[model samples]
Every structure is written in C-alpha cells, then in structure tokens.
Target: MKHIYTDLAVESKEIYNPEKKKEIEGVSVEVADEKNYSVTTVKVLNQKGSQKIRKPLGTYVTIDVPNLDKTDEDLKDEISIAFAKELKALIKEYKKNKILIIGLGNWNISSDSLGPKVIDKVLVTRQYFINYNKEFDETMANVAAISPGVMGLTGIETFDIVKGIVDKIQPDILIAVDALSSRKMDRISTTIQISDVGISPGSGVGNTRAGLTKETLGLPVIAIGIPTVVNAATMVNDTMDLIIHSMKEQAEIGSEFYSLLEGLSKEDKYKLIEEVLSPFMGNVIVTPKDIDVLIDDLSIIVANGLNIAIHPGIDIADVNRYIR
Candidate 1:
C-alpha cells in the first residue's frame, strides 16, 4: 500500500476512494453542512474498516471550515459551536466527570504551538476544586490542563507524564490537543479532527511515541487535532492533479493525450513524486506563510469549543471572557 501521510481520518477515507463513490466495507461516512462549515463523521466500525483505512476502530469527526483563513468572529463562533456539538456528543456520558486536558506540542514552534496556546485559554477549575474542596456545581466541572513539552525538551515521555498525572489526579477522562499533518494544502490550519480512539503524539511528523488510549490510560481519551502542516510531496501531487485536470478539460476527450491523462494513476504519481523529492527534501513538511495568525485564531476557536463542551455552564459569550 502506498503510504499517504495524513492525520485526518477523512483524508484517509478519501485516499481510499479517489473517485469518492465506492464505500468501504466496514467503514461508514456521513456529512452534514452547517452554517459556516461542514461536519464529516467517519466511523471505522470493525477490524475490516480499521485495516482498510489504516485507522483504529473508532469515530473521527472532521469540522471543515472553508473560510477558516478569514478572521471573522461570526465564523469562529459558528465553527466553535459545531466543534462543541461534536465533542459534546462524544463525551456526553462523561460530562460531569473529572476531565484532564493534555496539550501536546512544543510551544516554541509556531506551527506546533497550538496545543500550548489552547491550554492558555481553556478554563481550568480543578485547582479551585482541589484548593477549596468545593463540590461540583452545575456551572463548571472539575477541569485540569497541562502543556507538556515534547520529549526533546522535557526529557520525559509524554505518556509517562500523562500517566503520572492521571494516576495522581485520577481524572475520569482525558482530552488531548495537538497539531497534525494533512495530505491537502487547503486543509492546513483549516481543519479540526476530533476522535474517540485517542492519538499517538508526533505521529503526523513520523516521530510517533506511545499512544494515549483507553487501553493504555485506563480511561476514555478524546483527541482533538488541527492540521498545521502537510507533506510537500503530497502538495506537489495535488498540484499535478490540478494540472492534469486543466489539460484534460482543454484537450479532445478521445485524444491520445486525454487518454494518457485519464489513465495516470494517482498512487503511481504520488510514489514518483515522493521518490524524486526524497533526495532533495527528505520528508519535507510545508505550512502556510500565515500559520502564526492562523494558529492564534484556531487556538481560540478550539479553546472556546472545549470550554463550552466540557463546562455546560459556559456558553459562547462567557467562553471568550475567559480567554486571554
């Protein structure tokens, strides 16, 4: 199988079916159009679906905001609401339980700083509950967060750090936020993927560590990720597709050139592109020029969604007030 590096499960499904027509045996997909964005739910139902998509058996919700690059408050709110709705559905049963949010990334890098930035804005009430010994209120649940730097900086495995905290705090559930890589350029910084199967930190960049899942943590883990980068080879492959499409449009349908273009296999082309770029730019990752600003806006959107979803007492209006 041709390895296509993408953190979004929707992309994986798309790759599985380039024509977007056939349905995988055990996988199911449903898409709903929202006011400002669209929600795509891709479920890997069983082992067959899991192996077909190369994803674990779980639900992956992708919030696609086409105008994500635009800095508009209304758009942000709409996306945040959609995000909260999806996240709420996933953790509805544990809404009143103790939740630990782990922000997994390096704060120094702009592309990878989303996790830490979100931690800055998320409402953390666990400290209050611990210090004052306050009982659970309707307005807020016991929430705690940590921005554990990458292993390179902390010299400690992320899972170890999280395990220790989980053992100490004994939170009922875990929510991990991190930056991810996508196969499409347009998805970079514009897509949010929420999954119930948990995530392997640094997996998108090929430095995968121990996975943070129910099997490992002994608690349900919800992973929320935004694509901050895309593989350069994948971008080139997409560009090639566009070019071929443009040529085919101008050429006669029955012409030899048109036939050749139609017969060009995406998998073979992607492999060729990867081979050609390997020597010059081995596993090169690409991010948008405005990634810094994109991350700032996205972090706020994600934090607001998380705040509203995890704390029923907080709504969109009150969520921004808590964010710096």
Candidate 2:
C-alpha cells in the first residue's frame, strides 16, 4: 500500500494516533526542550508497537531546532550541546565504552553528505587506544568512526563493510549516522533523530538495504539522523491537503461540495494524489537550495553530539577546547 515515507517516530505516532486508542500499544512518548530545540523521545516496545510504527523495538529520540537552514553560530552551539546531552541520556543504559561510529552516506553528494561530513569532524581515538593499550587522556574514549562510500561507488553493501569492521574492532557499542528524508519540507535539516533501533542504509529514500542491529552484528547499535530531503509525491499530497483545507475554510458553510470534500478519507486522498503525481515525479526527492551551508553546520552539531555521548569524561566545553 502507498504511504508517506518518514524517518521520524513522532510522525509515525501522529499518523497512528487517530486510528489507535488513547495510547498506542507498547509505545511511549516523552518530550523535553533545550534552549530553542524541542526534544522528543519515542520508545517502541514489543513486536506489536514495532510493527505499528514500522521501526524496531527501541528508543527513538528527535531534536527539533529552529533556523537550522540559516547560518547562526550561537544557535548551532546550542543545538550541538542539546543533541549531545540527549544522546548521552539515551545511551546511558549501555555500559560499554568501546564505540564504533559508522557514517553512512556518500560524501560526494551534498544532499547525502551528512554522515561523511560529520565523520570528518568527529574526534577519533581508536588509534590512540590501540597503540598505548590504555587510556591516553581523561577526555578521550575508545572512539573510532568510518564513512564507507555508498554501494554504487564501492560496489559493496553498507552493512557488509560495517560488519567486517565490527568483526575486527569488536567495539562494545555501534553508532550509525545518516541523512534521512522527511514527509514535510519544513522539517528538512531542522530535526535530528537518535535511536537504538539500528538502521537500514538508504532506507530514508526507499532503497532499504540490510539493517545493522544487535542480532545481526553481535552488539548494540545506535542510529542518529537528520532529515535532509522530502519525497516529491508526499510533498504534493500534503500541498493538496492544505489547498483542500483552505478551500473548505473559505467556502460557504453547508455547501454540498465542501461537505463532499470533507467526507473524503485521508487514505483515499493520499492514494489519489500519489497516483496522479507518480507518472511525472514519483522518484523525485526535494531538498533545500542552501543545503551546502546546512550540511556543514549540521555536521558540527552531529559530530559534537556523538563526541560528547561517546566520551563520558568530556563535556561540550572540553570538546570545544580540544577541537579548537
């Protein structure tokens, strides 16, 4: 069946709310804020909730910050700190210290460059740990990261590459970062999702590959992402809905046509809209024109977030001093 493609659990919850009861089975939502960022955490427990949400049974945390598309130094720092702190809280239960960070995307493509960009900014400590066979400094952790070029470039599956590395490094926890697609345009580059549900490379744009999960890789997996694009069909459908809503609000009350429009089910509307747009723009992906700037700024936010989360002894201030 045709449905909106979104990498956000909160959005999935929003979609399932009307159909389910007061609460979804095995699903919980917790919300908090950090400065200008709105952090939402969704926990999907059990197989039922996993099936309903179309995500694995784990916690998914999303941080929504304002003006991410625009360049603002102060706002970027705030988001980085917030993202890092939230990431720490999510991974607290995992006592493992050896961390392997996987940056999943093609750096050559700006729109898909989020993972590799962040990888460049990440503070690597694996060599230091491996060399000395002991902790080097108070601010460092056994952190290592990689950016395996996409399958088309390397001709190797993303999961396979990560699996090979995991087998050799034997890290306690695995963190994967990627660029995702959203159903709403406004959400692009403005939202970050960190989850323990693992991840499927290329799943954000519908080309789902193998997933990197604990069961598959023999270790816990943490996935962090920011939506950078939107499906054209989904965008068109939402626009049509907005237009319908505007027409209904302006049209005379009790009109036959307005009532008829109101009576159309959401599923019917989405399907009809997708069918109409599929012929022309089915595989179209929409991204902001200023994505070049957004990617650079976002990489810092995400890289710092991962740094603070992976290294418990260091905070954002310490990271700033170290990076500088």
Candidate 3:
C-alpha cells in the first residue's frame, strides 16, 4: 500500500528515501526563494530520471505563493510576472505558431471553477485573426481556448472532446489548466504547478481517466494547475499526529496509552484510522471556506500570466488594461 498520495512532484520527493535514490545525471533541480513566492524547478533528464522521480521526463515548475489567499495585488502582479517568465522559457520553441488552451473542470463547483474562471479573463485572439486575416498585430499568437465542462455534466470524455479540437486546430502546443488535489490542506489555491509532461484530467482528484498529454495529443502539452482541495483522510491523520506528539511531550515515557499511540507504525496507524473513518468519509475532499475569493484572485493572476506569455507585445500593464 502506498503510504502517501500526492499530485505534486515536490511532495513525492519528501516521502522517498534519499539513500535509496541516487541523483541521476542530467536531472536538475533549482529553487528560488523570494519574499512573496518560492519557485521549485524540477528538470527530469532521461527515462531513468523520470523513473527515479516518478514524473515524466520533462520540466516541472512549481510556484508557491503563500499570500495568494489574501488579497495582495502588488504581490499578485509580482507572481504573475515571475510565472510568465517561467512559461515563456518552456514554450519558447513554439512562439511562431498557434496555441490552444483547455480549461478543465466543473464550473458549478466553487473550488473546481478556477480553470473556467481563468478562461473568462483570457484575451482570445483566434476569432479576430480568422475574421480579419492579417489585420491584427502579427506578434499576437493565434490563441484559442475552451472550457470543456467535466465528464459528469457533458456525458463525454474530456480527452475525446480535447482530441477533436486538437485534430481540428492542430495547434503547435496545448496548455491545459485544471484544479488539482494536494495532500496538504495549506496548498489549496496557494500553489501553482506547471509541467511540460502534461496532466491527467480526473486523476488529480482520484478519478483516473484518459489523460491529456503529449502521448495522447501528438503535440507538446503544458499543464498548469493549483491545488484546490485535499484528501479528508490525510487531514485527520495529520491532526492525530500533532495530538499524539503533544501527548508524548506532556505524558510520562512509559504511560500505556501514550506508548500505544507512539508504538503503532505509521502504516498501521493510517490503516486503523482509515478503516474507522471509511464508513462516513471515504474519499472525502476538503476545501477552504473562502475558496470563492481565492479562486477570483488566482484566476486573474494566472490569466494575466498567460496573456503576457502568449502576446509578445503585451506587458503586465497592458494585460491589466485589456482585462479591466
């Protein structure tokens, strides 16, 4: 049984035994710690590196902005500029061609609405180019986007819908945006993970479906996502661990109850607690009470970054002017 499950590659590193895994050649990791945000870049080299890291052999860039939940426009602009820089590096090779952006989620759910919300704020130039034909600025990419509602609502596979669009547009690259699930509650709406390896649509929330990746789409796919919810079981386990540690510090060393709690192996403790809570809260997901506010701020931040990345002539100021 897996001890922990996380969609974030950085978190996966925390669980694996460092002694058993050697640093593969060509794989690189760099971190930038700033006052407002932290950026972790994981570049997987060969297939061997991918296996060692349990991630696709591509670049995974994660930006953690702790104050995202709080309304901080100046900090938001900083993050947006930083995030756009990272995106430009990843898609620099395909700047001369069309780009398709897919917003994957159920808009009716507040936590899941991040992708669609971002789509709403993006500056779509595809229609203008088609209708005008060389009238608009040549620097602007032929950028198009869609918010394909979730499988339950549309009664269609997300992959199938995306594949149809890909076949028609044949974009040089695809950028997919979706809400993700993280093991820690604090990451919800606060962390953005961008990967050249693409994404698994429903897999983030434990519903594994056909993924949207380079292998499936036959083109380079970039995925951008934010952790919007966390597993309920993990929430309970973390709380119990804190309680057990507190009890251990306060209680005598040989106290039976304290000893019992401390003696249970991590795996066994998780199993025991999971079984006890399974009847009521199996596969439960927890989100913040202020998710609506968080989503609004994050959507603008992400959309602004995309606008700057897709349009070479536009700056953060230009994006803000157009968006407002």
Candidate 4:
C-alpha cells in the first residue's frame, strides 16, 4: 500500500490511502510504496492531542537475551552465546583497526535515552583484554563510545561534534543507537533496524541534528534504534475508537442482539471502553496491567539484538528463536 502525507500549518499529515486524497487538505494524496526523495512530510498532524515538544521519530529494535525467563539462566546464557557469535561476524567486517560507537540521543530526555543507556552497557573487549595503564594504550583501544547530547546544550552542531571527535580519535567504524517514532503502535515494543547509512538525530522533528551518514561522517556508520514515541494522529485514532464504541451501543446502530453497555457506572464504562479499544492506540508508553510484564520481558529481547549487533562474534539463532 502507498502512504500519502500532507502538511497543514506547523504539523505534517498523512493518509495511507490515495482515496483519502479528497479528504485531506491541500495537495492530492497518492498511494505508492516508494517515496519521493523531495517529498519530506509523509504525514502531517492528521489528528490532534497533547502538544508535547516535537521529536524525530522512527522504529528501533532492541534486544536483551539473558532475561528471557525469570528462572531460566540457561536460556539466557544460550541467548548470549548465540548473540556473541552473530556480533563477531559483523565485527569481522571492521578488520580495519578502530571502531567508534556513537550513542546518539539527548541523555536528559527519558524518551531519547536509548542510545546512552545502551552505550553504558557495551563491553569494550579491547579495554580489558590487554591490561595496560598508559595514554598510548587507551588511545590505541579498538572500541570507544560517546553519547553526544542533543545540540541544544553544546552550541556546536552534531556533525561538527562528531567531526571534532573523529579528528581527535580517528575511528574506523561508527555505530549509533537512538530512539525513534512510529506511526503504528504495535511496532513500539519490538522493531530494530540496522543500516550502514548513518542517521539524522532530530530529523523527524523540526530541529534537524547534523546527520551522521557515510557521506557526512567519512566512515562506515551503523545505526540501531527502538521506537520511543508515537504521533498525535494516533491519539485521534484512540478517540475515534471511543466514539465508535458509543455509536455501536445505540439501538439504531445495533438493534438485533443488543449488547448494550447499560449497568456500568461512568468510570467503569470508561474503563471497559478503554480496554476494548487499547490496541488501536498506537505506540502507547503506558502498558495495561496484564501486558506490563510482557512489555518488560520484551525489553530484554530487544537489548539482546543490540548486544549481538555490537559484539560481532555472538550466534543469535538462539536469541532470535526466543524473541520470535
């Protein structure tokens, strides 16, 4: 299916169907799987809700294999071993000398903390392998990671910060991890995309971070991410769900075997309605009571994917099987 997007005012709007072209304002919306490089706004603010500071959003996949089962340390171990194997393969590509891991995100913001969080956990094999306490030794370390905060504080552009860092350290490869946004909520929990092409930290939002692409960084760049937020249009979808449920209760709407929501109090009714329509709410940061544990469980799975992606010698078949 093709996705059509339009911008109205400061916000961008989107419609997946070309048939909705007449429904959308401004240009005629057409449906095509491929995107026009020039057409930036794929979707404008289709629906409105809370006015939060805008942030660039996309989907990211995170994996953490060890925590698969509460008591199953064996499974976790197996996952880790497998992950190590896969990562080793990827690492072999960087036979060239230096590897720099750039954790891209604003550490201050909870929504953008993925990059920094994962960076802290990375196991720098070179650091521990050969015990040494010398400036040359540290400088010669194969892997070095940095979490360059958002451009807001540093006065310098992201590209410039990376360039300065690069000039000083000179690494062979760059791997960046950051949070992203997704139009669909189902993908929020588990979706990791790795690409050699670097990333634009705040492109989804109006504030564009200096991009860290192969062209800009002058090195091979790999990006890993998880979707941290959903847009307001998803909120509109949630509201419509409530409206539809209310409409469905009307006799004119469903007269045959009336399944009316009659005896429940206002609070109870609202709760029930919300429960019934939760799935339509895209990328919900809030988890339902029943799904809370499940969501938490998935976090480990995502972290494992990232672990395997970075470590370069981990076999992830076991990890992939558990997550799948």
Candidate 5:
C-alpha cells in the first residue's frame, strides 16, 4: 500500500532478448555482462506436493535481460505481461483459483526492499478486468497484490499479514517478491529470480520471519526476487578471477587459456581457475569490506525486474523518447 521506491529511472528498462521465450521447460540462471553472460541450471529433486520449485533460474530473469535505464512504470508493464503468461498456464489447471501478488521486504530499507519498489508500479487488474469483461468477454480476471513488510516495531509477521489478506480475498495463487542475497557481488544488480515455493521474509539476514509459502498459505505461491545483497565470500571469488587472468598472461600455456577465458564470464573463468589452482587459496575472503552501495543498486534492479516481469507490455522507447 505504501509506495516506496524513489529516484525513478524509466529508461532503465532493458529487454536483452525480446525474442527469448518468456517461459522455458526449465529455469536457466545467468550472470550479466556487456556481451556474453553465464547461465546455470539448478535441479531440486527432493520436493513434493502439487507445487514444485521449477528452477534456480526462477529467481534470475532480469539479470539475463539487457538494458536498465527504465522507469518503474515501464518495468511494471513488462512484469505484468510475464506474470499473466505464467498465470495463464497455471489457470488452465485451476479455473476457480484466485491470484494474489505479494511483495515482501521493508520499504524503508531501500537496498533490502525490492518488493515494495515493484509493488508500487504494478497495475492492479482485478477491478479493471472485471469491468472490462462485463462489456468485452475475456477468459482471465482473478488477481491481487500486496507487500508484506519486514518485522519492525509493527510486530507483524509476514505470514500473518499475508494470511489475513488471503483469508479475506481467498485468492487461488500468491506471487511474492523480495530482495535476495547472493554469493557474488557483480550479480547484485543484475539478477531476477522467480519461484513457486514462496519465501521466508528476512531469511537472507539472521532474522527469519514466518514463511509465506504455498504449504502455509494454502495456495499456489510464486516468489520473485533479485540478489540485492552479496556475501563477503564473493569478494574472495572476484579476486580469484583477477589472479587467474594475471597468471594466464605470464605463462607459456596462458595464450590458449586466455583466449578461452576471454569468452567465458568472470564467474565461469573463476570456477575453472579455482579447480586448477585449488592448492593456492586454502580459504580466504577478498571482496570489499563494504556492501552498502552494491546492495542499494541491486534492490533497484530487482524492483525494476519484478515490474518488468509482471508487466512486459510497457514501451521503454516511448518513455525514453518522451522524457528526453
């Protein structure tokens, strides 16, 4: 209900691969880059029930999408379309189900609050769809949006806040959004992840609030997030990247390795080098001692990605052209 994101940048919207299929058979994870990026697929096999966590990539679409100078509104349009597409497939199985979009996290803490920023830009369609369908027939219409804030002096648990809303609305589906922590730093501002398993608000930190998952909410829950925060471990990872490149430049076998390395993402190359040079770094941490700005920008990117995923129809060109 509270609109939190400020310093709006409409032009930040970027669709790296418009031709890319919005939904794939499995989730694909990717790291951002100027040219090529890294994509990884995680398999979660021990899950049960009607709901399954489809892919680790579910939480990382925006990182794969290119372009950033976009406004919240533009990104919202993108997010809406993608959400609709995803829901459309789900609705075919459960026509009677209601849909709730919950944005999770605190609005005051900008870096840790991608959910609030995205919720602010979402275009509420429940009322609009109902009115539009009365005159013009349409097949879809049940949806709602909410942001379950982090526990503060309010003492409100995310589960209770979301549950209370769900009790009244009786939605069939719940899609929650929030900021996430990553093992890497460059990934901070470049990743958007989605999942059906819901999320535990503030879990990235030591504060693990009540979970808002499908099992608890008694609805099909989808979670969307971005890695707004990076752990100190990633700094160690980044340093290895530099060391490999430095070592490669000075070795006889370095030329061929350097050529292959140039084509690989910083993450992938780091992994390869790590396997070969495991003896050197027994255990270390090299990332920056500070993470304030990194987290701030990551939150914004995720907020924008959530908006874009739920409302993909927005025209960034129009906004950019008009603003200029």
Candidate 6:
C-alpha cells in the first residue's frame, strides 16, 4: 500500500477503510453534523487499533468546515464556538487549573506560522494571576502561552525548551498547537484536529522531533493542529485518479482500456508517480496561494476558541472585542 502522509487520524481511518463499510477491530468512530461544520471522532482503544491506524492510542476529534478558507466574521465566530465546545469537552477536568499553551512552528514561513500567530491572539493571564495572587473570578484560569522557535533559529530542541517551562511552571494541563500536512488539497486550512495524544513537532514535514506527551512532560497534553500544506505527489496522484475515472467513463464496458484502468491499484499508481517525481521534486510541498490570509484567519479562529475554552469567563463577543 502507498504510505499515505497525513497528520489527521480521521484520514488515517479513511485510508484503512476507503469504502467506510465494516468496523475496525479496536477502533471506534463517531461522526456528527453540525450547523456549519462536521465533527468526526476517532478513538484508538488499544495497541491493536494503534497499529492499524499508525496513530497513538487516544481520542482524535476532527472538525471539517468546507468554507473555512473563505469564511467571514459570522462564520469564523461560529467555527470558533464549535471549536471551543469540542476543546472544552477534552479539558473539562482542568478548567480551573493552571494551563500552558505552546505554539510550535516557524513564524517566518506563512504556511508554517499557524502556531505563533495563534499565540499572539490567545488571551494570556498567568502573569496577572501571579502578580495579584488572587482569582478575579471563578471562571478565570491561569493561562500562559509561548511560541518556541524551531531548532534552526534557537539551537535548542523544542521538547527541551517546553520541558524546562513545564518544570518551572508546573501547569496542570498543556495544549500545543502546530501546522500539519494533509493528503488532500481541499483539507488544507479547512480542517482542525484536536487530539489528546499530544504531538510530534515537524513530523508532517518529515522533520520528526521529540514528542511532547504525558510521559515526557508529566501532565495531560492536548494537541490542536490545522492542515496547511499537502504533498505534491499525493495531489498529482489524486488528479491522475480523476483523469483515469473520466477516461474510463467514455470507454466501452468490455474494452481493454477499461479493464486496464480498473486493474490499476492505488498503491502501484502512487508508487509510480512518486518514482517519477522524487528526483526533481524531492518531497515538494504544496500550499494555497492565499496562505497569508488563510493563516491570519485560522490563527484568530483557533485563538478565539482557545480563549473561550480555557477561560470560562470569555465568549465569542469578548474574544472578538479584544482580538479584533
């Protein structure tokens, strides 16, 4: 089978069962359709499920908004509210505890800048809590945020930096945000994945880093990611599939060309495409032309959701008033 590259568990599940017919052995999936978006939850129950999906044993919630790239203020607000609802469910136990938000990515590149951009918009109140030494309200939480640059710029592993902060602050919960890679073009910037399995920084781009997980950090780690790029080979393979389907439609039922097209397995085709492109492209990545605007909009959407989820006192209106 072709090694499908995707940072989404839902996509991995789909790749496991393209027909979406029968159930996997140890995996459970539930999907819900909301007003403007859809939510798909994939839970890897044990080692069996983990091996099948190539994902850690945890809950991965995917939010798909078709119009995310072209969203207006109203749609952004709606998406943020939906995001907050899902995020709130995951961290309900630590709502009032000290929380740390780590934005993991390079801010210099627009396609890889989702994390840092979100940090700029997120509401940080940890300093205020420390200075005054009192809770302003029952809904308030001590929230701190940081955007740790990549190793190339700082000469330090992201995990080391995060571990140092975690040791010092001793937060009850940690949330890490980063950009991801998708196998499909339409999913880029239109999908948000919230998982309890934590994250491996730069893994989507083949730059795997040490993961920030419960075992490594000694706390519950939540990961929120948005797909900002897609592999060029995957995109070309999809286009070839479409072209083959179109050609097959015009061919006679019993024609040799039809049979040949039908017999071409996705794995074989993808491998052939990869072989053809590898020399020149060398793992080329493709992102939308309007990535700057997409990054800007997505950052606000994620930040607003984090604010509303972490700070119970905040809402869409409150976040908008401050962020916008």
| Range of the 10 consecutive residues with the lowest summed lDDT in candidate 4 | 1-10
List runs of model 5 lying over 4 Å from the truth: 1-41, 47-63, 66-97, 127-140, 244-324
Q: Which regions in candidate 3 have their CA more than 4 angstroms from the true location? A: 17-27, 46-49, 135-138, 255-269
Model 4 Cα lDDT, one tens digit per residue, 113-159:
67766666554544643355333332233567778777776767778
Residues 1-324 of candidate 2 have per-residue lDDT tens digits of 566688888878876674545788889988886557788889998899988878788899988876776788778777888888888887889856688988999998899999999889898888888788885456677888899988999999998999999999888899998999888787899999998879888877889899989899999898999999998877876787677778888878655676676566655666777788779777889998988989998898888777777776767786677762
- The local lDDT score (0 to 100) that residue 145 gets in candidate 4 is 73
lDDT of 3: 0.82
Structural similarity to truth (TM-score) of each candidate: 0.96, 0.93, 0.90, 0.53, 0.57, 0.96
Candidate 6: misplaced stretches above 4 Å? 253-255
- Steric collisions counted per model: 0, 0, 0, 48, 38, 0
lDDT tens per residue, model 6, 6-78:
8999988887776799888889999999878999999999999999888999999999999999959899999
Candidate 2 ranges beyond 4 A from true positions: 18-21, 135-137, 253-255, 321-324
Tell me the TM-score of model 6: 0.96
Better of 2 and 6 by lDDT: 6
For candidate 3, write residues 268-289 as lDDT tens digits. 6667777888898887788999
List the lowest-lDDT window of 10 residues for candidate 2. Answer: 13-22
How much is the lDDT of residue 319 in candidate 2? 63
Scored against the true structure, residue 284 in model 4 reaches a CA lDDT of 38
lDDT agreement of model 6 with the native: 0.90
